[model samples]
Target: MELTADQDDELRALTTSSEVSAAVGTRARIVLWHAEGRMKKDIAVLAGVSRPTVDLWLGRYAADGAAGLFATKPGGPREQVSADVRSHVLALTRVTPPAETGLSHWSTRTMADYVTRTTGTPISHHWVANLWREHGLKPQKQGTFKLSKDPAFADKVADIVGLYLDPPGSAVVLSLDEKTQIQALDRTQPLLPIEFDRSEQRTHDYVRHGTTNLFAALNVGTGEVVGDCVPSRNGPAFLAFLKKAVAPHAGREIHVVLDNLSTHTTPDVKAWLAANPNVHFHFTPTGSSWLNQIETWFGIITRQAIRRGTFASVQVLVRTIRAYITSWNTDPRPFQWTATADEILAKVRLTQLNIKKLVANNTK
Candidate 1:
């Protein structure tokens, strides 16, 4: 069997491309070997198939050229699922299940059963699951988001992000926040050391020794942290920590980026700002605490130091925190802010538009 130049190239691609399935590639090889003037028995050995299989594919190629190689044998007619049923399944999956069903969300099994009973169409959970995958639906997962209500949100974002991206010469920019109510928890039983096949284990129950609050300031340029474990989180505590945090950068102008908390705007804080003209405070938008870079450091400290430590007392926890900060400062790595203010605003606007459309649809 002789192949046209196009047919030869196409067949070679099917046999060599990683994406082509093994079965299809093997069939392509059989056709190529036949076109190469190889005997059916030799082609069968080379292609790892019976001599009859080679004849079958060669016959197909003879009849329809290269296209016949990819044609699948017909499996007969199947029971067609109505378009209305598919639309109904998708619509149900997108909303919360009815209160009568005692379900907060719809599962594949429950959705299938409900559709079967209501539509009088026999459907399996497997079919419903496939439909969900095709539509990129995942009922098992959830995400959280909050829209900032601060009227000056856009301006505040520009100011903070500007400071992050391009700070003034000889100025120190600090992302400051307080992690409140850090509990010093002690396990009831001793922790079990990890073995060859077992993970390290600790008691599920723990004794709460005491709680402490941590006030932290992250220097954006150097990534060094200035933190203190205070007995309480208040205006006075915050002001004291602020003084300590800025002590090293005494001569330089300081730009402190912080969240909008009640303690942050107290009369005493305002008085301190008035007393020190060099220190400026920039508040993030309300309900948008994530704009501060210090929060990222707080998460890292929690995962590494405090979460699994056995603290007999708050003092022990404090010491542990101090040690961790000291270790972090020795080789600090700064967190880089890459998103531009315009990019952030664009995404926020898109989110707002989507939320508006969602609310309008629900009302209808």
Candidate 2:
């Protein structure tokens, strides 16, 4: 079917509305009904619209086939902040605190004021926002994390990573790390289904089910995870976890890369170390905890498996974690480290040389 100029305009006008809107869907359904040769009342009943509305749409469609459902009102090209002016504003943003603009972090209103002050152009707040976005700029806060410092840390890291990188025959390569004192919280309400006229579900307050220290080791070759929940996450606990991760396999060297916590280098750990020539530990470069493979898996668990979770108790949380591990292990896939041996070695040398330079400076 085809439409007249008036019908084309009517259909084209719908471009302003979203595709999922009832107005658009209604037009589609009506056109489909007309194509099927259904009467106006029957189409109205099926589409949940009034008979008159159906007739109006059908009349429009009869006059103008597919083109009638849309309107072609033109919009003018958007006025934008000039390239020079935007760059100037961005430079100002870096030098001047947002307080001078009467707002924080270069908001649209603030940017508008800044542009006006510098160029005397009465830029609208909305235009200011679009211009900032156009120039690839937005307000964002910086994140923070703890740093590590351990002498001889990098030299031994390779030997630790070797278990995963190139393990001894018939040996399991486990990447071990501890996530400490994880709080088990339960939401008060079940998640509400998304629907019309339904009450939103919410948690009035959270129930603390107690905290558990997660001592986890990832078998990179096998892609299986061995995890334990303990009451504490101290150095002693770490040694115990090492014992558990290493105990199952005999006569094979288990290379593990981890952070240098005080507990990890304790006397008990030293004694354990003496006993197990089969187990080796590697430490990541200071401020580079992100290099640990076990930490990568931990990120997956936090985002995909544990974020916004509600457990009934510590036991329930443990059970859920176990179930998740079981499900994951069913399709155990090995993870390959992409960073080259040379990159690792270079950073190690740089860190060691920097330390030596510091020591020489102190002596002088």
Best candidate according to TM-score: 1
Worst 10 residues of 1 by lDDT: 194-203
- Model 1: C-alpha RMSD to truth? 17.9
Clashing pairs in 1: none
**Shift in Å, residue 289, candidate 1:** 0.7
Tens digits of lDDT, candidate 2, 1-364: 3322233333333423343354654575566545445677877766678888887777755543433443324686676666655555555433323344444244444556666865665676556545544555443211112223555545555555555566678766677788886778886532221221223222124889898878888887877887888888787788878888877777776777677778789999988888878777776666656667788777667645564468878887777777877787899766887665567667556545544553454355
Measured against the true structure, the TM-scores of the candidates, in listed sequence, are: 0.61, 0.52
For 201-267, candidate 1 gives per-residue lDDT tens digits of 2113588999999999999999999999999899999989999999999988999999878898899
Consecutive 10-residue window with the lowest summed lDDT within model 2: 195-204
Report the backbone clash tally of model 1: 0
Local error of candidate 1 at residue 260 (angstroms): 2.2
Q: What is the number of backbone collisions in each predicted candidate, taken in the order shown?
A: 0, 14
Q: Report every candidate's CA lDDT.
A: 0.78, 0.61
The true-versus-predicted C-alpha distance at residue 236 of model 1, in Å, is 1.0
